[model samples]
Target: MSKVSLPRHVHRVVSRGREYFYYQERRGTLHAGERIRLPNDPQTPEFWNAVRQAQGTFGPTPTDTIGALIDAFEVSWATRQRKISKGTQEHYRRYLKPARKAWGDLPARELRPRHVDALIRKIGADKPGAANNILDALKAMVSWANGPVELLTHDPTQGVERFSKGEGHRPWTSQQLAFAEQVFTGTIRRFFFLSRYTGQRISDVVRLSPNDVDDGGFSLPQKKTGVKPWCPIFPELEAEMVTWERRPGPYLLQSSGKSAGKPFSTNQMWKAFDRERKKYSVLSGAVPHGLRANAVIRLRGEGYTALQISDMVGMSVEMVESYSRHADRKASGQAVLREFQERDASQIVKRLESGKRK
Candidate 1:
C-alpha cells in the first residue's frame, strides 16, 4: 500500500505490514498524552468523523472549566476505576451531552445550587423524567469531582433538587395480566412471561437464554446491581417455557427485519411491548418495569416474606416491601380478621360450657 498523507496530530504506524492510525495530542498541550485510535482508511468519511470527534473531545479544553472537569472525570470513571457499569455509563452520557453543551465553558467553581435549580426547571418544564436523569448525572459527576478527583472544593449540587417523578410504572393488575395473556403471543408473550416471572429488569430479561436455565432456575448476574441470584422457575413460567422453541443466542431474538437473529435491544423490546400494551385500553398504564412489582406482589401473596422475596429477586428487602405494599396490607388485614374470628369462637365455646355447668 502507498503511503497516505495524514492530518495534523494524526499519526500512522505499520505493524505486520498493516497500517493503523492514531490521534495523539502534541507535547505541552492542554490535553497532552491523550491518544485515540482512528479508522484505517483516511480516504473514508468515518476516519475524518472519528478524527473530528477525538479532536473535539481530547482537544484543548479550557482549564478549571466544567468541560475539562467532565472530560477528566469521564476518563477516570471509564478507564481508571471503572466502577460504573456500561449501561449506566451510557445513561449518564445521554444526560451529560446536554449539560456539557449548556455549561461546558462555565467555571467549575462558579457552579451553584441556583444554577442547577434553574437547569432542572428548564429541562423539567416538558420532561420531568429527563430533568431528573440529568440532575442525577450532574450529582454523580459533582460528587466524584468533589471526593476522589478533588477538582472542586465545594459541592454545587448540595441544595439542588430533582424534579418530581410521579408514581412511576404502576404494577399490572391481575385483570391486566389476564388481558395481556389473551392479547400477546409468541415473542411478545415470552418477553412478558420472563419479565413477570423472573422479576428481573428488562436489561437482564432480554439477555436470558435457555442455557441460563437449569433444574433450579435462571442463573445470571444482574446487569445493574451485579447480584447473581438463582431465580426459581415458577410453575406458570415453567409451563410457558416448555412451549418455547429454544434458540442459539438470547431466548428472545428479533423475529424479523434486518436485525433478525440478533437479540432485542432494551429500547426495541420497550417499543414492541408498548405497541402491544397500547392496543388495549386496560393496559394503558402498565409498563415493563411494573412486571417486577407484579412478581413481588405475587410472591407476597404466596406467603413469602419480604426477606425471602428479596433473596429470590436480587432486590433489597426494603424494595420488595415497597413493591408489595398493597399485598402486605391485604395480608395484614386478613390475618387480623382471622385472629378476631378465632377469639370470638373460643369465647362462645367457653360461655356454652359455663351455662351447662350452671
Candidate 2:
C-alpha cells in the first residue's frame, strides 16, 4: 500500500510486514505520555478520535487555563454541541494556534482586553487580515468560555477592535461580465453562471448536485450558515443547464486529472476559475466569490428587497444589504433624481398655467 500522511505525534511502523500506527510522545519531552496504538486507516473519523484521546492523556491541564478552554471549545465543535461547518472549524483553528502558542498556559480569568488589543496590534503590523481573524477567533472562544459554565469572569476581547480592511471581494462590473460571456466556456462558464445566479458561496456552489434540484428549485442547505433556502431556477441559469449533458453525480465535475470525473474541491475550483480569469485584463479584478455579490446586486436592481434577497440566498439580511450597497446607492440616487425631475416638471406646469391666466 502507498504511504499515507499522518497527523502530528503519530508514527507508522512496519512489524512483520504489517503496518501499524501509534501516537507516541517525544521521549525527552517534560511531560512524556505513554504510546497508544492508532487505527490503521488515518482517513477514518475513529482514527482522529483516538488521536484526540491520546493528546488528552498527555498531561493534566489546569481547568482555568486558556489552553484547557480552547481544548474544551474544540471538543464542543467536534462533538457538534457548538455546531459549525468544517471549513469554519479549520479557519478558527488556524487563528487559534497563535493564541494557544502565546497564552495557552495563562489563566483564562487573567486575560484582559489590553492583552487582546496588544496581540491584535502586533499581528496587525504585518498582516491585518490575519490579525482580524485572530481577534474573531479569540472573541468566539472567550464568549463560549463565559457562557453557562462561566470559565471566565469577564470578556477579555471586549472593546478589542479589528484591524480596518477594505470591503472584501469586489463585485464584478457589467462590462467585465459581458467580456466573460464572450471568452469563457464549458465548466468555467457554468461556474460563473451558477455563482452569478444562486448567490451562494463558492463552498456551496462546488457541492451543488443535480440531486439537490426539485420542481420548486434547488433546495440547498447552505454549508456555512446551515440555512436551507430554496433557490429559484432563474431563466439565465436554466438556459445554461439545458445545454449541459446530464451527469450522475455533481453538476460540476473535474474534467481532467487523476481526480477527473470527481467533484472539484473548493481550492481546485478556485484555482481553475482564477486561471481562466487571469487571461483577460477586464476580469483581473473579478473573482469567483465576487459572482455572489454580483448575483445580490442583480437581484436588488430587479427590485428585490433585502428580506427577499436574504430568503432566496440563505444569507443574513445584513450580509445581503452589505453586498447590495452599490445597488442601494444607485437606487437611492435614482429616487432623488426622480424627485428633483418631478418637482421641476410641476413648477414648469404651474408657470404655463400662470401664463395662460395672464
Candidate 3:
C-alpha cells in the first residue's frame, strides 16, 4: 500500500473574537494571518457552502485553522447542550450565537485571551452562573481541539472568573411545601413530594417510571452526574406511585402521549409548576429545583448527618456540605426562623421568674 504524503502544516491558532492567527501553504508559498474574518453563524451555511464550492480552492477537506474550529466547537456544544433543557439551553445559546458571529471563521491557534474575556464578561453581566458554565464547556472543547493539532500550549480558561454561590442555596419552608401540595395534583403532587423528599432534580425526576421503583427503593440515573441514584422510597410515596402507575401513562407526570411519546420538556414542566404555584398563591419565584435545597435545610434541622443526607439525596459529599450547613429538621413547612424563635420566648420568661425568687 502506498502511503499518502502528509500535507504541509497549515498554520493553527486559538480563536479571538473578530480575529485569530493562521498559517497557510499556497503553491509552495507560506504565509500567516491573524484574526481573519470568517462567516458568522448567520453566514455559516453560506460560508461552508462556499467552502464546498471552493473545495479544491485550498485543498481536500480544507478546514478552518485551530482558532476557527474552536468557535465551531462552541456552536455545536451550545446546540447540543440546549437540547438538555429549552430555557437552560437558550441561556447558553444567547452567548454562543454572538460568539460564533464574532469568531466563527478564525483558526484555532489565533484565539486570544481577550476574546475569552469578552465572551465571559458578556455572559456574566446578565447571568453570572451561565458565564461560568460556558467558560468551562469551552475549556473542554479547546483542550480537545488543541491536542489534535497542538494549536495551543496553555488553556485559556485557567484564569477565567467563576460565578459566586450568592448568599446560600435557595430554601423553601414546610409551609411552602404544604401550599405546593395543595396547588399541584395527581402525578404532579407525587412528583413534588418526591422532589422534597429525595431532592432529586426535577429534570431527573420527570422521566421516572414505575419500573424505576424496585427492591424496596427507587434507582434513578442522574442526568447531570450520570450516577445511579438508588434510595429507599417512602412507604407512602411508594404506594402513591403504585396507584398512579395503575392508571394509563408512561411518565409519572406529562411527557409522552399514552404509552409511546416524547419526554416532557424542562421548560414545560417548570411552566406547569409556576401555574400551580400561582393558583395556590403561596410564594413567588420559588422554582422546582429549590426543593432540593429546601430538603437539605429541612433534614439538617432534624439533626441528620450530612453523609446520611447525601446518601438519601444522591448528591456528593462536597455538594452536601455546599447545600446543607446543618441536620434532621424539615424545611418544607417550618415557620420563619425569626418567628419560631420569638414564639419560644416563654422559656426566657420562666428563667427570669426563678432568678427573682432567689
Candidate 4:
C-alpha cells in the first residue's frame, strides 16, 4: 500500500475495510458539520480541487481586523452568488476558525507579507498543501476588501511562497473504459455513460434534473468553472437518457434504500460511485472523473476542434488539448501516412513508364 498525504487538520480512518477522510479543528467542525469524504485510491483532479478548496486559515476584533474582513468577504458576492462551490465555503469557514484565534483582533491594514509568511511556515510544517490553500483564501479575502470602504490598502498574501502542489490525477484509458462498462450495472452503468458522454464531474452529474434535458441539449453550470454550456445529446447518449426512469424527484440520479428515490449529497454520491467502482478489476489509476478525459479524447479522434470540444465540455482549450494529446498523435501519424502513399503512387507510375520506354 502507498502512503497518502492528507491536507492540514485532515485525518483518515478505515471502517469496515473502507477509507474516509475529513478536516477537524480542535473546537469547531469543518463545513458546518457536513462531512467531506475525500476520494479514495487514485486521487483525480476533482479530488485535488476538493482538497485544495477546503483548507484555509477567522473573526472579530474590529471592523478593520483580518477576521472582520474575512467575515465580510464570506457574505460578499463571490460566496453569496455561488461563484464558489459549497465545499469552498466550508473551507473558508474551517481555516478562518483558527485564524480568528490567532489574529482576529489585529488590524487588517497593518498586515504585511512577512506576517503571512510566518503563519504559512507554521502551517506548512504540518501540511504544505493546506498552507497553500489557506494562503489562497487570505488572498481572496484581501482582494475582496480593496474597495473604498474596505479594510486594507495592500494584500499581505501577495508575495507569500506557495508550497508545491504536485501534478493532479491521471487520465483514464480505453481498456479501463471497456472494463468499467462491462462490470458496472444499473445506476452505476448509467452514471458511467452519463459522465463519459457529458464530461461532467460526479458532483454536478448527480444533481442533474430531468427538466435539464431538452431538444437543444443538457443545460447546467459546471461546478468547478461556473460556466454553463449546452451539450448536445448525441444519439447514443440521448437514447439512454431518454429511457431513464427518474425517481419522483428533481435529481436525475436518485439513492436506493431507506433514502430511496432521494437526491444524493456530494459525499453520498462519490461513496456510492466508489463502492461500485471498487468491484471491478480495472486499472489501478482509474477514476470516475477520468471520463472527462475519455470524452475529450474521443471527440478529438472524431475530428472535433479544440474550441468545439471546449464549448461542448465546458472546459478551456488548454485543458482539452492536455487530455487529447493521444488523439493528436494518432492524427499526425495518419497525415504522414497519407503523404507517403501519395508520393509512392506517383513514383510507381513514373517507374512503369520508364520500363515501357526501355
Candidate 4 regions exceeding 4 Å error are: 1-63, 78-107, 115-135, 161-167, 223-225, 250-255, 325-358
lDDT: worst 10-residue window of model 2: 41-50
- Candidate 2, 1-358: lDDT as tens digits: 5444466789888899998999988844888778889878654435655776788845543556776677666655644454687667788889999998888889877888998899899999999989999999998878777786566778899898987765767898889888887788988988888888998888899989899997857887887667888789899899989999987887889889798889888899999998887777788878888888888898898988999988888888988888888778988999999999999999889988889632
Model 3 residue 269 distance off true place after TM-score fit, in angstroms:
1.5
| lDDT at position 301, candidate 1 | 90
Q: For candidate 3, give the lDDT of residue 228.
A: 70
Compared with the true structure, all predictions reach lDDT values of 0.82, 0.82, 0.60, 0.70
lDDT of 3 at 225: 59
RMSD to the hidden true structure, all candidates: 7.9, 7.4, 11.5, 13.7
Global CA lDDT computed for model 2: 0.82
Question: Each candidate's TM vs. the true structure?
Answer: 0.76, 0.79, 0.64, 0.66
lDDT of 4 by residue, 4-67 (tens): 4445666677889877767554426443544556556323333443454455321112346665
For residues 1-358, what per-residue lDDT tens digits would candidate 1 score against the true structure?
Answer: 4444466888887899898999887845886867888878664435655776787855543567776676655545434443666667777878888777888789889988888888888989999999999889888888878886578898877877777656566789889999888888988999999999999999999999978886769988888767777899999999988998865789898888899888988889999888887788998788999999999889899889988888889898978877788777888999999999999998889988889633
Residue 297 miss distance in model 1 (angstroms): 1.5
- Kindly report the root-mean-square deviation of model 4 from the true structure over all alpha carbons: 13.7
Better of 1 and 4 by lDDT: 1
Better of 1 and 3 by TM-score: 1
* Candidate with best TM-score: 2
